[model samples]
Each structure stands twice: as structure tokens, then as C-alpha cells.
Target: MKIAFVANTCWNIYNFRKGLVHHFLSKGDEVIVLAPKDEYTDRIKSWGVKWLDTPLEGTSVNPFREFKYLLRIYSIFKSERPALALTYTIKPNIYSSLVSKWTPTKVICNVSGLGTIFLTTGLIGKLALILYRQAFKFSSYVFFQNSDDRELFTSKIKVESYKIGLIPGSGINLEQFKPLAFTQNTKTKFLMISRLIIEKGVREYAEAAKAFKDDKNVAFTLVGKFDTNHSRSIDEKELKQWITNGWIQYQPHSDNISNIIESHDVIVLPSYREGTPRTLLEGAAHARPLLASDVPGCREVVKNGYNGFLFEPLNSSSLINKMKLFLSLSIDEKKHLANNSRELVEKNFDEKLVVDAYEEAIHRIIKVS
Candidate 1:
């Protein structure tokens, strides 16, 4: 069977969902990659998957541009005639599902987190929900990374519960991210690995870091690059100011995420929401304690005084309080958190679970369709 994975960016497919691609290929199924071409397209093609470039403006809300994107997606599906279409991110999920409705392609939508528009109570949020409701009602299946997201999306859109599936975020390769022994130092290092954008809770992280300015021992660090094209991006001038003022140490994005994790003590992600926080999985795999917002995807990772602690969303004070609690932990307490972190990831969030699930879902869809 020929299967297609539709996403907004080829980078997302190559980097995040590579395991799932391998699963289909290993099963002797032909896999097609569809997304806006970038540097990673060649890399993805080298993996033996066929690439079809589908142009899109990821951050745009303009209906005219979105309509064009939708039509282009429809044209691709109409021509390729894939047996099954698996879509990730916002544009691909909705637009691809819409196209599948008119084609023989059976679409499986992966709700990889609701982006900025869904977080808002304004016109954009309402508009996005309406579109989601329309496209999803016709979908073959809906896969959510966490139950909270599945419940929220299905409740709003009225989809079949039988059609809903759950996956741990694209998932973390335990072999690549397995735990390393750590020792506590007088200076507790806190690190946040994320794109520099507002919705990622960058501002909240910055504020929480600022609250610890007078603490000479603890260091607040951010690792990841600025996402310039994204609408929720942090202002370049302000980011520079944060660095200049010595509020936080900003590290450039690196290919070796495990190396970056090794250099930090505690991993933090105060994101407003997520499909699942990949960084937390990476950190936990490396046996590092976590700090995250007490929201959906985040809560799935942190089990309050278990693997790590959870704080109120958007509350810098709450984050600061959690940080303080983490710092005050005895060596035994810290070790307990680290042990739990590794155990939790090993038992639940292994990357194989996600890839195998996708393969099974695609096979089942093909068998029944």
C-alpha cells in the first residue's frame, strides 16, 4: 500500500516523525512525503521516501492564502491517489482532510497540539474551531498525543469516539536519549529548550528567570533559536536586551540535544499547551527532573513530586516557587526525581509505541477501506 504523511514542513517530518516513516518502510509499504520543501527535503528523500513539495504559509490566517493552500493540497491528493494520508500540524490536518473528503484517500489527522489561534478567545479562535469542526467531521480517524487534547477537540467538533486514537508525542528514541549519571552542584542550572516564541511560554520563562536574579548560585539558561517567520516570535530587540541585561544565558540551537541536556540540571518548559512536550521526554530520558506548566501536554510529563513538579500556567510566581522547591530538595529527593523521570519515560513514552501505532492504524485503515 502507498501511504502519505502530510505536514506543514519537511523539517517536521524528517526530525520529529522519522520513526513512523521507518515503520511503514519496514513493512514494505511505499511512503510519500508531502510538505513545503526546505533543506531537509533532500535529507528526507535520501531516506527513500518520495517527496512532493506542497507550498504553504504556516503562520498565516488569511482565508485567500489558506484557500490556495487547500487547493494545492487537493490537487496533490487527487493526483497521487494515496491509499492512506496521515497529517500533522494545523494546515495539513484540516486542509488535507478536506481534500480527502472528495478523493479516495482516507485521512488520519494527528492533532499535534492546537496552535496559537486555538489558544485565543478572539475571532481567529472562533474561525479556526469552525474550520476544524467542518474538516474533522469527514475524517477517517483522529490521533491525539494526549487525552486532554482528544477530549477537547472531539467535544468541540463532534467526531466518532471509535475513530479517536492516542499516541505519546511522535516519541523519543530511548537509545539516543537514555539517562546519564548526574551530580548536583552548588549552582543549580535550569534550562529551557524551545523556539523563542510567545506561545512557547518564552515570556513567562524570562519573567520567572528574572525573579531569581539575586540568586548567585542558580543559572537560568535557554537553548534554541529564534523562529523569525512565526507570528508569535519574540522581538529580536527584546531578546538581545534579555541577554545584555544578564537575565538569562541564551544558547544557539544545536543538533546534539542530548549534549545540551547533559550540561543542564533541571529542564523547564512552561508552554501554554502542547501535543506533548518533546524536550521534557528528552530530558526525562536523560534522567533530568522537569518543571512545566500545569496544562494538558505538560501534566502528562510531570507527575507532581514524582518525576518533577507542575506549576500554574502563565504564572511566573508559580514557576519561581517550583524552582525554589526543586533547588531546596535534598540530594536523596533529587535522586528520586531523576530515577522516576527515567522510569516514567522507559515505561510509557518510548518512540516505538508511536511508530508502531501509526503503522497499525494505517494497515487497519487499508484493510477496512
Candidate 2:
């Protein structure tokens, strides 16, 4: 069987779905990729999967542009004639499903997360819901990273229950993110790994760090790239101001996420929303305690007091209070929490489990189609 993965970014596939792609290839299935090409496009081709460079404008929401995109996707789907099409992100899921409706091929759409448009009940949100309702109704299976998202889509967007499936984000590789031995270091270092965007609460984390700057024993590190497309991106000027004022130590994003998690005492993600935070799962798999917002995606991974503590979304004082609580725990207690985090991930969020489930879903669609 020929399998095709349709995504907005090749980087997402490279970062999260490499294992799934390898699993299909190992089983002697022909695998192809359909996405906008970037630096990673050639790299994926080097790994033996065929690449179809479908050009798309940057994550824009203009109706005219989106219609043009749908036409382009339809052309690609007609030419490729994949036996199964697995799509991720907004445009790929809706447009690819719409295009594949004419073919006998099965379509699997992963609603990774409902982005900014779905967070409100305004015009755009209503429009997005209508689009999702229509698009997802046609999917052979719609995979969601968290139950909260699934419920939201089912209730608000009016998607069918039987079409929905659950996955633990893209999932974390336990072998790649092994548990680190807890060692007492002089400084209680806290790391926040995410795109430096306002919606991710980057500024809130900085303010909270400033509140604790007097504590000489605790250090805060911010790691991630600046997302130019996000409306609330932390611009160069703001980032420079934060660094110059000594609010937190800043580090550029790196592919070496496991090592980054290992070096930190605690991991933080103050995101306003998520599908499921891949960083928090990675940190937990590396036996690191968490401090994240009490939002949908974050709460799913950090169980308030069990594996980690949660703060109010976008509340700097709340984040500061949680950070203080984490700092007050004894070294042994912290280690115990870290161990529990890894145990939770091992049992519920293993990367192989996600791959196996996806493979089974695709095969089932193929068998029954």
C-alpha cells in the first residue's frame, strides 16, 4: 500500500512523525510526503520517502488564498493517487480531505490543536467551527491529542463521534528521552521551551522570573525560536530588552531537546493553549518535574500536584507562586515527582504506542475501504 503524509511543515513530520514514517517503510509500504518544502524537504528525501513539494502561503487565513490552496491540494491528490492520506494541521486536514473525497483512498486527519481562531466565540471562531464540521465529517478517522479537544470539537463543531480517535500528542520517544539521575546542583534551574510568542506566555514567564530574581540560588532559562507568523510574537526589541534587564537567561532553540531537558532542574510551559505540549512530555520522559499553565493541553500532562504543579493561564503572579512552591520542595521530593512524571509518560505517552495506533487505523481504513 502507498501511504502519504500531508502536513503544513516538513519540520513537524521530521520532529514528531519520523518513527511512524520509519515503521511504515520497514513494513515494505511505499511512503510519500506532501507539504511545503523548506530546509527539511531534501533531508526527508534523503531518508528514502518521496517528497511532493506543494507550495502554500504562510499560515494565512484569507478566504481567497485558502481557496487557491484547496485547488492546489486537489491537483496534487489527483496526481499522487495515494492509497491512504494522513494529514496534520489546519489547512492540510480540511483541504486534503476535501480533495480526497472524490477518490477511493482513505483519509486520516489529525487535529493536532485548535489554534487561535477557535479560542473565541466570535465571527472567525464560528466560521472555523463550520469549516471543521464540514471537513472532519468526511474524514475516515479524526485523531485528537487530548480528550478535551475531542469533546470541544464534537460538541461545538458538531463532528461525528465515531470518526474521532485519541492519541498522546505526536508522542515522545522514551529511549531518546531517558530518565536522568537526579543530582543536587547549586542552582535550581528552570527551563521554558516553546516558541517565543505572547500566546505561549513568554512575557508572563519573564515577569514571574523577575519576581524571583532576588533568589540567588534559582536560575531561569528561556529556550525557543521567535515565531514570526504568530500575531503575538516576541519581537527582537522585546527579546533584547528582557535579556539586557536580566529577567532570564536566553538560549536559541536547538534540536538537542533531550540534553536541554537533562540540564534543567524543572521544566515550564506557560502556554495559553496546546494540542498536547510535546516539550512537557519530553521533559517528563527525561524525569523532569513541570510548571505549566492550567490550560487544556498543559493540564492533560501535568496533574496539578502529582507529576507537577499548574499555574493560572497568563497570570504572572500565579506562575511566581507555583515556582516558589516547586522551589520549596525537598530534593528527595522533587526526585520522586520527577520519577512519577517519567512513569506516567512511560505508561500513557510512549511514541511507539502512537505509531502503532496510527498504523492500525490506516490499515483498517485500507481493509474496509
Candidate lDDT scores, in order, read: 0.87, 0.84
Cα deviation of 88, candidate 1, in Å: 0.4
The runs of at least 3 residues in candidate 2 whose Cα sits more than 4 Å from the true structure, single-residue gaps closed, are 120-126
- Cα lDDT tens digits, model 2, 1-369, are 888899888988898788889888998888899888887888788879999877776446688888988887777677777888889887788878777677666789988777555664555566666677677767798899888888877777766666778999988888878999877889989999988877788989889888877888988899988877766588889888888888789887786877877788999998888899998998899999999999888898999888899999979999999998988899888998899899999998999989988977876677733
Lowest lDDT sum, 10 consecutive residues, model 1, at 115-124
Worst 10 residues of 2 by lDDT: 115-124
lDDT of 1: 0.87
- Candidate 1's error at 60, in angstroms? 1.7
Candidate closest to the true structure, highest lDDT: 1
Please list the residue runs of candidate 1 whose C-alpha ends up more than 4 Å from where it truly belongs after superposition.
none
